[model samples]
Target: MSIQLNHTIVAARDKETSAKFLSGVLGVPVGPRFGPFVPVEMSNGVTLDFIDTGGEPITAQHYAFLVSENEFDAIFGRIREAGMAYYADPHHAQPQQINHRDGGRGVYFDDPNGHNLEILTRPYGSGPP
Candidate 1:
């Protein structure tokens, strides 16, 4: 059996605001609310569940997205137009810009929840210089 990721629970001070922020960045719609959760679904059928924490301290999480070259260009363009800082590597080896590592491009940024979000046009070994 193939082991696939299920879903991740993101802590949010306000579910609606967090969901809206993510929806704007990911270019997806925030679905209906259920209990304390507001979910955003990706094109791949994965769901990101935003849970209201009511002022509780929530640790930051990192999320990575594997996208196509065209998608990366569009998303990175949006990120730049929004003045968001982005990077190529997870360790943040490079800063304030995009990286064409293994033949593809990648960028990283933070979400409203302080989650490290990344967009990569290719896999790890596929990055370019």
Candidate 2:
């Protein structure tokens, strides 16, 4: 049998808040709680299980999602409507702008937990870089 990513633990100050935030942004439902974790499953069947940090220092992590053009538009619109700051680059060099990389649109933004979240219409390295 082939191995695949099933789930990952995401450290958050509040599991419910983080799970809800991600679910809302991705337009997906937050999964039922399992023990101390509040899960949000992606379309690929991988789950991001949010758990409280319990006073532990949380380090930022980057997560990138490849979405369709329509999904990107809907998600980006939610980002804008929420008044969240977004950058065209991962380093945040370009403010309030989206990048046209790999011949598709992409944007980087920070989640409430300070995790770097990226959404793009095309997969990186799929075309001319």
lDDT tens digits, residue span 1-129, model 2: 899999999999999999999899889899999999999999999999999999899999998988999999999999999999999999999999999988999999998889999999999878854
Error of 2 at 73 (Å): 0.3
lDDT of 2: 0.93
Q: What are the per-model numbers of colliding residue pairs?
A: 8, 0
Q: Which sections of candidate 1 miss by over 4 Å?
A: 1-3, 126-129
TM-score of candidate 1 to 2 decimals: 0.86
Candidate with the greatest lDDT versus the true structure: 2
RMSD of each: 2.3, 1.4
TM per candidate comes to 0.86, 0.96
Q: Write candidate 1's Cα lDDT for 22-43 as tens digits.
A: 7887677998887778999888
Lowest summed lDDT window (length 10), candidate 1: 120-129
- lDDT of candidate 1? 0.81
